[model samples]
Target: MEQNPPKSIASIKEKLKKSREREEECATNLQLLRQDLIKARTAAIDVVMAHQKAVVKLDEELEENAKDLKNVHVHFLSEREALLSSFVGSLLRKEKATGKTPPQPDAPRFVAPLHTPTILCFLRTHLGKPGMLYCGRKVLECEDFMLKTNRERMELLFAQHRCFGCFLPLSVAGHLKLSDCPHPRYCAICDSKDHHQILCAARRVYQGVIPE
Candidate 1:
């Protein structure tokens, strides 16, 4: 009976040892799982930060592109205005010296049909008038003839490449023409909308410069 008791005690001790070993193994597995979880969390955070940076860079690039496009548009408009002014000035000098209106250039007319009447009206009012020069201003009273005339008005009227009223290029102007507002008037030199030639600021400045 004593021997049997000893064997039972030894068996119990062996079971206790095995139980402790199992506990240690479970703790090790839990620690490894915790480390894996921490690594996963770190990786996820890094990915989110990288994604945010990419988005910010994309936004910056888009803004820069928009600015570049705007600059290009402004440059194009200025070039068109300068070319038109030069062409008209040359034509006027030729016409005045020859005592006859010159032939119209064979350039492609890009102005819309709806805007044609307005251009024609402007031309009829100012074309071939005496003592008039293309100085990029609206009509003013001629000191000699007492007649209201402006050669610059004709220059802007024939500017089919852009709107002299709003200074919008043809591509944008074609899409934005107002159906209700036909025959809109503007200063040829300054591009002031809904203004008359007589009240044009540029005309006043030009008149001030004339030697009385």
Candidate 2:
């Protein structure tokens, strides 16, 4: 004969309730893990986007740098060409100027009015004759009012470079039409600061032409 199974129904129901609670807890844990994985994937995607943005920014910066370099190169080349053109123009202008005649210096200076030696008045007043009449002689023989010593002085101190027909001594001032010289007062003929008997009027008259 099969005896009836001794059954604790309350214990059996309690075990079943515990198993359902474990299964619900496992499902909740799985859902939480899936949510955490989705959040991690989203974060990785955001990081990749950030990296891509950085790369794009770098590419733009490189492009800008290249453009700047190109502009600088063009500008420099243009400047160089302009400078070359300017230099060539300057050379052409120089050549043109060189082909023309050079500027000339100023002309020689023209001197003033001519000097003509006319007869002086000292011999007419005092000696009654020109100084030429007094040849190589003592001063007193010509009735010269100067003393014997002065006559000797005239004879010794001075001599004739030329027998100027109408010339007078530079010392005689009153009617002596004298002339000056460009050289230092060193000429032997005129015996004055001006020119000498070399250009004196008596020589010119004797030559029959007034010195121009």
Residue pairs in clash, model 1:
none
Which digits, one per residue and each the tens of the lDDT, describe model 1 over residues 1-212?
Answer: 66999999999999999999999999999999999999999999999999999999999999999767755654454456557656756767788899996666697322221222222222233444676433322222221111212334334433534444433444755544433234566444344455443223333333432222
Query: Highest TM-score: which candidate?
Result: 1
- Quote the lDDT for 9 in model 2: 65
TM-score of each: 0.49, 0.41
lDDT of each: 0.51, 0.44
Q: After superposition, which runs of candidate 2 have C-alpha atoms over 4 Å from their true positions?
A: 1-7, 100-212
TM-score of 1: 0.49
lDDT of 2 by residue, 52-112 (tens): 9999999999999976775565445434534654565566578777896434439522111
Q: Candidate 1: lDDT of 113?
A: 18
Give the Cα error of residue 174 in candidate 1, in Å: 40
